[model samples]
Target: MSLDFVNTYSQLINLSADADPSTFYSTEDYRKLQTLGPSLPTLSYPFPSAEANLVGESTIDVKLKSIRPPFKFTTELKAIPGSLSIYKLKNQLIDEVVSLKEAGICASNLKFMIKSKILTDTTTIGLLGDEVSITVMITQPSHNDTSKLLSDPEPELEAPKSISKGAWDKIESVLSADLGPEAAKIAVSKFKQVSI
Candidate 1:
């Protein structure tokens, strides 16, 4: 059975676009996407065998470590049995991240990292099973930057000088093409009210 891996990966892009960082983190799907295995070691045995072996945990602490603005995390997208070209998938992710950054919809203080790497038959056993995959990471800016980001006023968009019949028609047509017809109609109505 062939699965549409491109569509699956596309959903990730959509998720980023539709949901903010906090909202995304709150979802069950995001919880499942967390890095597997205990990053910190416990005194418990590493194996379930009769002999108990105590392992020393890493002394390095994350809190003590300085995390700069743009904290980053990586996620891997595995290709389906009959998926599109790996390059296409990689490009889609890059484009989506770029779009999100350009739209300023990422978050108040956070920046989306747009780096991606393609892997095939590598040692890295991505979140999914062995398959052609793309590993992408996005950066989460530091909490300290939030206040500054929120303090800044959003730049105002330039309103049209006058919405003539021809201009209105053009606006509606462009909106309809970009968004759906229903959204375009509502937006045009709103724009008209604002211009008045």
Candidate 2:
């Protein structure tokens, strides 16, 4: 049998705290997270009507970033059958992160919005009727070192990608390997969805 999907999902649930996960909804912060505002209309995947439907509830995965605090975090969501909307689901995740931050369970970080789309499958017709589940993976700056910005904090320097490419690549490699090829690719894909 294929690797236990639940096991994969479990791993995602416990993704490392070093990812700087947090919930901040301000536009400026959201843009800094590299996300275009939430999709005009939140996507929704209505509960399947048939009881026999293989809803794939067990496959839903959630991953946190893998870097330390004093940073911002973004969660990129992915799904199969591009039509399967999960904007609300992402919002809920954001809310959870925020609550966790408020409770001191999680730290404050730059907030980011999620972008959702179906995976490699092209058959869009009735895609939602099939086994579809949404997954979230977090992205964050590689280091908490803001020394460069401190000396000359310019609007250009505010963007992390320009300053953190090398560090981000290293973290991405370690994380991708940890997630395994397939899952790692999915996570990376989600990362690109927002980053682009």
Candidate 2 ranges beyond 4 A from true positions? 1-49, 54-58, 66-84, 99-196
TM-score of 1: 0.19
Displacement of residue 61 (Cα, Å) in model 2 is 1.6
lDDT of 2: 0.45
What's the lDDT for all of these models? 0.45, 0.45
Query: On residues 29-90, what C-alpha lDDT tens digit does candidate 1 reach at each position?
Result: 67655443223324554555433221321111011111242433333433322323333443
How well does candidate 1 score on lDDT at residue 88?
Answer: 41
Can you write out model 2's per-residue Cα lDDT over 1-196, one digit (the tens) per residue? 2366556655755663433445454556555664332233334657656443545332333333423343335443334223323443434455656643443332122232223443332333233443433333343424555778798776654565442566656656887778876677677657767772
Q: What is the TM-score of each candidate against the true structure?
A: 0.19, 0.20
Q: After superposition, how far is residue 165 of candidate 2 from its true place, in Å?
A: 69
Residue clash pairs of candidate 1: 113-139
